[model samples]
Target: MFLPDAAATALLADALATTQPDLAVVHLHGDLGAGKSTLARAWLRALGVSGPVRSPTYTLVERYPLASGGEALHLDLYRIGDAGELEFLGLDDADARLWLVEWPERGLGALPVPDLEVHLGVEGDGRSCRLAFRGVAGESWLAALDERRRLRMLPEPSP
Candidate 1:
């Protein structure tokens, strides 16, 4: 999908937040300034995170306690030199309900397999996002999102 601006990105994030399951792993693929952190922040906000949402570029991972009584882990592996470095992050001990990972390729072997992958690229002054599913969970979520989009596109009934 083509996200013309930050508002469009937030809309997509809202859809995902509302339709997401209790447990999910989402990989955000993009380059510098490609809006990966923007989307992730929007998603977190949509999921009821009211506090600051910072990028994990230097810290590696940022954990948020959601209002829904679950945790969301956002990881930025751009600076990771080796996949083995993930072991030191203690990701296996985390009990987060959602995982939003940027630069997932850098932690390929150590990271959990993504249920859904959002690929973003710069297009004009906006960003283009492509959603790809890796399993049944992701497929179901995408189907719900598609249905939501379809419903929104429908014309309103006349009074």
Candidate 2:
């Protein structure tokens, strides 16, 4: 999909709201200014987050309770120089209902394996996105997304 700017990215994020499974790990990949955080913020908002949704770049982790009654942990691993740093985030806990990770490569084996991966790249004045699924849950999410597209709940990505 080609997202022509932050707004288009938000549109994709909003579409993602319908496909939120009970628990899943999502790895968002992209370069700086590629709209990873924008999509994350939009997704959180779509989940009914009424408060601020700030990037976890400096803070490392941010927590949000979904309106549907679950907790989401948003993590930015950009500052993580080593996997050992991830231990401080208490990732071992199973309480997180959803995990949204940025720079998952930095955490590598230390982080939960992603159920879904959203890869974004700069394309012209916009971003190109590809969604990859790793497990049954991820596959289900993609299927749900496809259904949304078929039902016209999601706008087709620009060619």
Candidate 3:
């Protein structure tokens, strides 16, 4: 499935809000400037976060406390030179948290299995994304996520 830049972000944000406020994770696979960070920001906002959301290309991860409940960690592994570095970031939060990880492949063997995977790409004048569910509980998100995709990947309107 795919989405227009804004709608995709909104869709993802809405989907994240349905995860029951516990530990959830999204592993995003995308190229540079393909709206990965935009989606993260939108999702975080939906989680009731109000602050500057920036890429953690250097810090590896940034934790934001949600007003609704729980914490969300946005992580970017682009600058990471090795997989071993993931251990130092301490991604496992015993208190339960939601993780948004980009360049997930870079961390490979070190990360846990994601409940959902968001794969995006730069397509023409906009962006496209695909969401794959890895667990049964993710079906709700998957359904809503696909509903958004149906429109984005729909036929261009009378162009």
Q: Which candidate achieves the best lDDT against the true structure?
A: 1
lDDT of each: 0.88, 0.82, 0.74
> Tens digit of lDDT per residue, candidate 1, span 1-159?
677788888887888888887899999999899999999999999998987899999999999998787799999999989999999998888889999999999998888889999999998878878888888898888788777783253223232
Estimate the overall C-alpha local distance difference test score of candidate 2.
0.82
Model 3 alpha-carbon miss at residue 47, Å: 0.8
How many backbone overlaps does candidate 3 show? Answer: 0
lDDT of model 1 at residue 156? 32
Indicate the residue-level lDDT of 107 in model 1: 92
Task: Sort all candidates by lDDT, best to worst.
Answer: 1, 2, 3
Candidate 1 is scored at a TM of: 0.92
Q: Give the per-residue lDDT of model 3 (tens digit) for 39-59.
A: 888888877788688778778
- Candidate 2 minimal-lDDT segment of 10 residues: 150-159
Model 3 spans with C-alpha error above 4 angstroms: 19-21, 93-96, 143-159
lDDT of 2 at 17: 67
C-alpha root-mean-square deviation, each candidate = 4.3, 2.0, 3.4
Q: Candidate 2's residue-wise lDDT over 41-152, tens digit each?
A: 9988877887789999999999998777768889999998998999988768647878889989999988878998999898888888887888888888888878777324
Q: Candidate 2 regions off by >4 Å?
A: 150-159
The lDDT of model 3 is: 0.74
Clashes of each: 0, 0, 0
